[model samples]
Target: MAEVMADNRVAGAKGDGRFEPIEDSQARMLADLYERHYEPIFRYCVHRLFDRTLAEDVVGAVFLDAARTIRNFRGSEEDEYRRWLYAIATNHIATHIRTSLRRRVLLQQAAEAGRLGPHDEPARTDGPEWPQVWRAIQTLGRNEQTILTLRFFENLDFASISAIVGKRETAVRTMLCRSLKKLRTQLKSVFDGDR
Candidate 1:
């Protein structure tokens, strides 16, 4: 934690590029940044991964990476910093999903479907196990999932999502609409199976 702070100190030291130890004020600022952004970042991870335990792990990694790089971070204010953090969280979750959890998610979805039969929507939609909906979400590409999580679950605007995803606002909006339509089509059977 101490190492995370202290990269920048005093006035013209930056031009000389000499490293100075962090003072109390800088430490406090770092603490404030973490306090301000930690929960939202964690929530993003939880929403994307659908596992609190895994989310916690991902959050830890994100903040650690942020801490290490915060000195170099160009963003002076919270909004830019927050966007950078989201970008980091996005990469971490995508990596986690790609490397470790893709097969598990597919298997879990299959098991849930097989066990629940064709009629059940979900036993508990609030928790990580929103069987039908989550299964449908799992079918989407990584960018679509990120867009949906940022837009609906995180309640972020399209422009913000575009910044995080490196796309234009229009592209973000278009992708979101297409993703929602796909999800609706996939879940149509689950919602209207009996009808």
Candidate 2:
């Protein structure tokens, strides 16, 4: 059809000369995905980036990435699409944090202020500042930081994290455990009297 041709996303024609239906379905599915997933994705970005404006930019980039690569996406199930979107978000957040010192500083400040802690409990201001511990977190590799963030900050389980990160569930668990142990060691140094 003229509309399909006019749209550059059709990828290519089948041997029968019909535009790939998967691309069309993907487009439609993306529309629906935007309606359903936008808010949660925005929240994820906001919590991770600690700035509404920056989060907005990152969320827009995620969806734009989804649209740009929709034709190449082979997933037919909604869960697959959701995992794909989170994977995109993960990469964008990491890229944003790496490229923008401002965002990283903001996240560090937020963590220092206890915004990153459990909401049910208030932060213990009596203790020393958490910048040292967070600096140790920063020293971790990107994959380690990502695993920690997805598990602790986003509250995602190992299974979901494995799907998002394209790792085996056991690998996700091992990575998370290793990252946590490293953080605990840093925490011990920061709070010398504490375990």
Candidate 3:
């Protein structure tokens, strides 16, 4: 319990005070943060990039950036840290997409390839219908994909997803509903052999 309290205190301290902890606590917090959110962030990245390796790199970069900047973090009643962490993930994914056209092409190619290797597959979405579902998700605008990933897979509330994606909660909800409808339509077409 002391460790949790200390962590809370450390998180709440303002200015440079939060950076005062020795490297050990810093490392511990980083590790704890990774343990808590790595999978969700990775899933978000892979959903965006469609490549396991690049997704892993993006997730690593997100957490590394988080570790370096966490001292400036402010406290919140909700899972603020998790939201902040995912915001970093979202930014890293966007930057990667902007910087690497070839990488984006390769990722899209892999997604179209339909192999679903060991790691890149969505958990429950991996059944016979997965190919259609994934392809539909890939078709979404990047913002829609990011919001859907945060809302459905990460189980984040609309407000937190709005904060992450820089939209109003109502907009997030509308976009998510639209994205899902698009997916349903695409999946129906796929199963109907429209492709």
Candidate 4:
């Protein structure tokens, strides 16, 4: 398509030899950013939500918000852009959790009022240790959960995570250390119980 070719041309062009509209440049940058960063963001969301469809929807929403705010985005470096995008994804996940909690509360209220029929019990897990680990992760405070997931599951270093989380590197390291210690303690108890 002509649009694709135009985008490619503008994207590959360095310096201001040719005049490209501001909108065109921003669009090209967004497309490039999406191509490079979408998978990592999607993985992060999937890890947080444990639902592929919801993760995909959240990814779409994250990019949509990024595109809208791209004009205000600063820093031309890849790492800075990554931090910005991850920050957006982090906020979206928080919103998703709040909404889910609100819905659950409303459903519970409805059931208590006798306006809804009884529902089946939640499913039980009978899988490997990873599922148990994930369940234990849910018991952590929100900050602890986010730090552990970013550090371990996403394989991000403390420096990058500090940027995404808006925390000092030292603070991030401290929280990560505390979170890992707590997680190890929790896992030990589970293994002890199994024996």
Q: Candidate 1: which pairs clash?
A: none
lDDT string, candidate 4, 80-164, tens digits: 9998998898889888877898653554454344443213644333423444566567667777778888998899988899988
Candidate 1 regions off by >4 Å?
A: 1-24, 110-129, 189-195
Tens digits of per-residue lDDT for model 1, 77-191: 7678888999999999989987987655665566467443234454554333354566678788899999998999889887789989999999888999999889878877655
Going through the candidates in order, what is the number of backbone clashes in each?
A: 0, 0, 0, 0
State which candidate, 2 or 3, has the greater lDDT: 2
For candidate 2, report its TM-score: 0.66
Every model's TM-score: 0.76, 0.66, 0.74, 0.72
Candidate 2, residues 53-93, lDDT tens digits: the string is 88899999999999999889999888788888989999998
Q: List the residue pairs that clash in candidate 4.
A: none
Q: For model 3, state the Cα shift of residue 185 in Å.
A: 2.2
lDDT of 3 at 181: 88
Quote the positional error of residue 90 for candidate 1 in Å.
0.1
For candidate 3, the 10 contiguous residues with the lowest summed lDDT are: 1-10
